[model samples]
Target: MSTSETTTMTAPNPAAARIPKKTVKDFKFIKEIGSGSYSTVFLAIESGTNRELAIKAVSKELVTRTKKISQVFREKDILALLTDCSYAVKLYCTFQDERTLYFGLTYCPNGDLLQYITDAGHLEEEVVRFYAAEIIEALEQLHNRHIVHRDLKPENILLTDDMHIQLTDFGSGVIMDNNDSPPQSNGTKNVDEEKKPIKRTNSFVGTAQFVAPEILKRGAIHVGSDLWSLGCIIYQMTTGKHLFRGHHEYDIYNAVARVSYKLPDDFPPLITDLVQNLVRLEPSERLGSEETGGMEKLKSHAFFSQFSYDTKWGNLLNQRSPLETKVKLSSRPKLSNDELETMSSGFDDRVEARLIGLRMASDAPNGIDAIVTGSSNISLSNETSSLHETDNQSTLSDQSSTKSMYNSPSSNSSFNNNAPVIARRLQMPDHALSLSEQASKNVYHKFVQNNLIIKQGILDKKKGLFAKRRMFLITEGPAIFYVDPDAMELKGTISWTADLRIEQKDMKTFLIHVPGRTYYLTDPDQDANTWCKSLISIHYRYYNTDPNRKLSTTTSYSSSSSSSAMQTIVPVTEL
Candidate 1:
């Protein structure tokens, strides 16, 4: 997932300032637990305390290169601020070396919600309610602090040994001023209300699958966006599939804008209702939007009515986790010294120049526009648009820092007060530049399909023929497509093709025959032949016909209001 652009390098209060810091040598590394483009998480044991912890190591060079130093500082500050909140991942301390910065965090023995969901396929209603309630509590704590957890997803929700969930990863969070008067629940200002326009930050961040409509539109985001993500997590837990499954960035964006998914009929009405309300297309109408009492409405939602909304939720720490892992966490792949070096080198002079722009910019931008470009295994391109500019500034670069200016005893007031102005023009990072081309391939290859195809096609998953022209990506998991690239409506799989068969429709088009649906795709005759060949290869790789190949059977169905019918089958054969 992408990290946040908002910058807060120091804690906002004295209590937060008191969080201790330890040297990296104070902990003994156990093994790698998690990894992303910018950082790596490891299991470690504190030498003096003999306590287990998860230590996230981030490359200082890479951070400086990507111009995300503010995000790093922001995460540290937020974690410290939430140290006493049991619902969030606790920050034990922080440490840094010349090369890397380290964050000592509470180790969740049961892994992340994503792992649990993968193991269980779909969680039972009771279990979903349990986790969702805890997540709501966490959000409440954050919202009360005027912080928006911009990155909320299963991967960021960690599980304690006793099955309780903790919200982690604040790198993508936004911290607003709590001193400001609250906006009306309707999120609109009356003419009689304060004349000051409500502060709204515009940035494109967070994972594609879980982004909210407001975020996708490249508009301003608020607490409501987090509620939308919560809805997605709940739906994913209940169905073992992302509410918005897309082939790539464009597809995910489309789903975010449309809110086209439907809850399974078997889902309790309350659960279905909660998900729908939370993910409403209109931000103000969302369950916890500013127009609402923020987290209060979320807590009182029907889906969580049965769960107690209190600190730690009473005795959850002693309860057994709903999902269990058979293998030791240390079994995850470890990074080699050479791999680490390569990751560290991901940033260059251009990247550092961008960081300078972010740190020095004065006139704050209103919206973020992205142009993904890069060749490495990891990179994302992002650009900020100034409200004053008629034409978008080309090539994305991190925007100005929102350094918090506080008078806490430990505050570095001088640095915060006199922050530099970011440069007007900057280039996007390489990984960001390649997000469209690489992120899909990387995420799908590692977690979903080992192979996939990216191209234009029509998706008739729920609408039958004449569905809008779209881009289709066929992976091992599903045939994901996008009806509206920016809106992010994930047109789900229309058929399971055992094999791909192409029939010529005309000189400008060809028909692809899959298991249950035949798609007529338009392409020049020359390219049509290649498209057919590639589609066949992709399908064959997914459902290998090798005689020695093992067979697995699993029933699948969609709950979209347009297609509620179900089917069961046995035996594996040709499409």
Candidate 2:
């Protein structure tokens, strides 16, 4: 281990779970290894055999707050299912505590491919092929299982003790079960239709830079999408930078949407051809798509055959990787004061503002919302308690039509006369309304949670009564507020995640603060008042149960799980 980096493994705490009493005391904590927003990876030792392994400890509360319940379940299932695949990571056992969940996994001592790439800046041709071949093999295994690995960056590719590659991180993966109707050769049909050559998904997920064109266009993706990401990784391996890097995340999205990127001029022709075949704009044009001979074309590519067409492909692992590809550990230097300040400042507010505007305008299917107000006719509400009982009577309804319920004057007139008198005349454009309704539908079923539409007040006093009527859905997360609802005129969008602070500024008004933005909302409309209170409630629930809040590190012991002990034993103890 590097001198500056400490590896930690926690000793099992008996009181953590209700399973076997003995399970908690089985593994001994050694040192802290790595940590993420919601989980920590530990380098632990099994007491029975004294064998070291890597275990991931994730907080249940954090997972729930992040709305990654499906991901958590999918990752666990994929790891367990792909244990036999040599190119995939192995999972031993899983156990959870009242505060955290644990997954015992094989330790990759040499670290990930990303670090090696950073150290070398770029890899040689032979080295890229070796890694690329292994990755292709890994993709083959995943594809055969009908699983699409939506995220495929170098960080998820770990190196074994011998420096061989093993794929990890299945959190963004999708498993194709019988429930989904496969897309037909001509096109996709409803879910009830018969199976076809491909499965189409509309989920907007995956790392921004590496996302495929199909994903950005229609939220539809197939197994071949992995090939597109693979092509990007191959390009990065040879050039040491992303093929589709833009000025910002949204720029990257636009680039992916158009497949507008150029490979290095110095790139080898054979390798270049291979990459081009994989990264075609249309899914069907990609090398591994059903129309393109799938894995056969990839395996038959000239680049892989450069080693020797007659040689058994798996035997390529026997050939030692280039000496330069080996990882060299170095101590991390302390950050300077200026660097510290920059790091602490989070994101640049100006850049974030622009990015948010672009995202809100382009991301949703309906494009952008149009807020058209007639004459100043209605007053805003200032007191939550003053909301009429009639406002509470209207329950949450589906947004199936383009016409917004906010424009109805009957709901807006109940506001206090002393409150700001903003015109209640609101008109949503057909495109924007349709998209918002679609977003609402997707959120309702995808999250498996009921979405409550509540009126939220705009806090900006400068905007006055002309501010757009904002929608709030506690379960949907990340409240998206429009500075201007019109698409063509002066307009922008500001969004806040569930993790931010939401404070009740007054009886009917609330304030939301994220890193670079602050939003205010006040509504005397019964529905708006109810929504504001709901926002306050949701904020407190998340804040009070902060997963990162320091918990009792000292564990209480009972007996350990015999099964857990037996499962963690490994042949190689260290990398």
Best by lDDT: 1
RMSD to truth, every model? 22.2, 21.0
**Regions more than 4 Å wrong, model 1:** 1-16, 178-202, 306-575
Query: Could you estimate the TM-score for every candidate?
Result: 0.55, 0.52
Where model 2 places Cα greater than 4 Å from the true spot, the runs are 1-22, 178-203, 308-311, 323-575
lDDT of 1 by residue, 1-575 (tens): 22333323432545456878788667656555555545767777666466788988887765765566767776776787787787899888887877778888999876777766765677888788877877877787787776778789987888776567899888877665436565444543333332222222334678777888766775554678888899999898888888886434555677678887767778778878888888888878888776765666677776666754442344455555444333244233444545433332212344334432432221112211110111111111122111111111111112422121111222421122112111111123332334344444333323212222333333222121112334455432224333333334443343443333444322234455443444545531123433443443333333332111112223232433112111111122211
Candidate achieving the largest TM-score: 1
